[model samples]
Target: MPASSTDAYITDFAEFVQASPSSYHAAAEVARRLEAAGFARLDERDEWPAGGRHVVVRDGAVIAWAAPEGAGPATPYRIVGAHTDSPSFKLKPRATSSSEGLLQAGVEVYGGPLLNSWLDRELELAGRIVTDDGGEHLVRTGPMLRIPQLAIHLDREVNKGLTLDKQRHLQPIWGAGGDGEILGELAASAGVPAEHVVGHDVLVADTQAPARFGLDGALFASGRMDNLSSVYAGLMALLGAPNDAEHISVLAAFDHEELGSESRSGASGPFLDDVLVRIGAGLGAGDVERRRAFAASWVVSSDAGHAVHPNYPDRHDPANRPVLGGGPLLKLNANQRYASDAAGAGFWAAVCRQAGVPSQPFVSNNSIPCGTTIGPLTATRLGIRTVDVGVPLLSMHSARELAHVDDLAALGAAMAAFLTPEV
Candidate 1:
């Protein structure tokens, strides 16, 4: 690859992170790119398009695929699955609250986030807001609502680590120092009256777009890297897939992986299975055996892996410290936190070799338990061969995260090769 190709990855990463304000936005962006490339959209509400047309499922979760104009069955569908959601603060039903005359929105921590990193940063609100005009309608207010942090003088225990009470301390103060109807203000921004706002699933997002870092500008700063990296890579792979296949190439991005994978849109739910059935039915092959064959298909469960922090080198396994720009990592754990088995890891390694990309393996120190992802759950649910792989990242759950600029391209290249591999 030329020097220009690396620049393209940084530029692409910036745009990709900005476009994905929320998981829904992330899924929508994937759908948008696939649709532009001649893929047709399918969901519970609409009939799947004819052959030569790519099929997409928009179950609030989006799964899109393209087959050759007349590709046959038994093509051994290549799959790249990722989640759209990340750990962040979610709004409560009665979100508005006030303390000491300052208006704030009550929030619940959605996942295991770095609580301290969010203490004194500029936070913004973004997500879908529901309204009842005649029935129900969706309105996306893409504005940045600032959440200012408290000053040092207020609490004398400055250096000491504080336990964050999710219910009491995590709510964000949102106004210019007074208690009032903030919902009305938000409603005005969305072009809806305050009282008409029935419900919302709002999240606090970093307003900063991803940017190049380091004196040489080798690193990149972005939000939602924990999973969005996988989302973007998978999208590129699905979009770049070739015309020949033993099975359909499916890209499924679930919405609630950060929480326990139990929600309708999470990995443990019926979303993936339902979408597979829908696609089979739309293709006029909705038999039990075909569905069984689909379940036997393979999946690449993509998510971010924690790189050994340069400043804190002892935190990683001595033999397996994945470095920046090294390559996509095959994450393994004896505890099954990650889903990679010998067969799955070997498959990914084969793809890396074919793509001419260097790869690494990561395992948490035995003293510390590793985190789980959708890899295992999806494998169990569908009995599909699944592997866990991701680019190495720093500040895993902080307000702002970092990763090498080239790794994005590396991951994308490897994924593209995997999705369109020759039979």
Candidate 2:
């Protein structure tokens, strides 16, 4: 790829990360972009027809697909799966609290975020707010909150090793001895009355915009890179890919992967299954034909993997050391943690080669415990072949993470090829 293509892809990605402050925002942004690209937006409560590009949004999840004119019963699905949610603090029901003249916002750790990374950053509150009439509205406060860390002078041993009390120490201060209601603020942001807004799903997000920095601007830093990078790649690939492939190309961006994907919009749930079944039915598929389609289908679960850290070399596997700009990772595990088998690995290699992109393999050290993604869960749920792959990042889950500009573009290229797989 030319330097110009890499630069353009990274610039658009920075804009995407900025627009998507929460899962809800991410899903909405993707649908909006797809719509702009001439894809029709479909409502789940309504009927769907096959043979064109269409997208559907379910809460913080979105599924988009393009079926060719010749798509039919045995026309399998080529799905690129990703998640919309990231680890962050979630606002509680009673979101406002006052302590010792400092007004704070009540919160609970939503997922396993590096809690220490949440310290002393300008944060925003963003998500969907629901009205009494069951109407949902997206709301966001650009930079209204902060979780300040205890001063070194006060803690004295802060550098030795830092510890945080999730309940006690994680509340973000938004005001001091003032009559400010977090709910009211969210309601106003959404143009709804606080009394009329009965429910919310707000999350804390970093306010700092993504940037290209480091030597010769090769490195990009941003929040929510773990799965958003995959989501964006899948979206770009789907948008730019030819819709006349032999199979149905689908982008399934689910929510709540950080929480084990159990919710209705999660990968472990029926979101993807529901969409696939409906698409098959629209193509005049019987139960037996649908089964045959599943047997021929594939799911590429793309999330973020780790780049071996310079300081803690022992933490990473010795032989397989993936670097920042090397390429996307073909993640594997001895257990079914990642669901990447030899067959899946070979498929990924062929896809990368077809796209003219490089690739690498990622496996955890024998001594360390490995983490899992939506790969195993999706494969088990649908009984379809699935492979785990992703861009290598310095910080897997942090307030801010580092990635290579070229890797982001390379992942998109590889995904585009996987969607239309010539091999």
- Specify the highest-lDDT model's number: 2
User: Across residues 1-423, which tens digit of lDDT does each residue of candidate 1 receive?
Assistant: 345877886688678888876776777778887888878766556665544545454433677776655544333456788888888888777877767777888777878888877766666666666677642323344443444445668867865856667776677777656556655655666778878888776677777668887867888888889888998888888777766655677788888888877888788899878766655654555466555665557888889998888899988898888999888889899877888999988889888877778889989988777888899998888777889999999998887888987787788888888887753
Q: Which residue pairs in candidate 2 have backbone atoms (N, alpha carbon, C) closer than 3 angstroms, thus clashing?
A: none
Clashing pairs in 1: 74-246, 75-245, 75-246, 75-247, 76-246, 76-247, 77-247
Alpha-carbon error at 19 in model 2, in Å? 0.8
RMSD of each: 2.4, 0.9
How many angstroms is residue 9 displaced in model 1 relative to the true structure, after the best TM-score fit? 2.3
State the lDDT of candidate 2 residue by residue for 193-243, as single tens digits.
Answer: 899988999999999999999899999999999889999999998997685
Could you tell me the C-alpha RMSD of candidate 1 in Å?
2.4
Segments of candidate 2 deviating more than 4 angstroms: none
The TM-score, computed over Cα atoms with residue i paired to residue i, of candidate 2 is 0.99
Worst 10 residues of 1 by lDDT: 135-144
**Best by the TM-score measure:** 2
Quantify all predictions' global Cα lDDT against the true fold.
0.76, 0.93
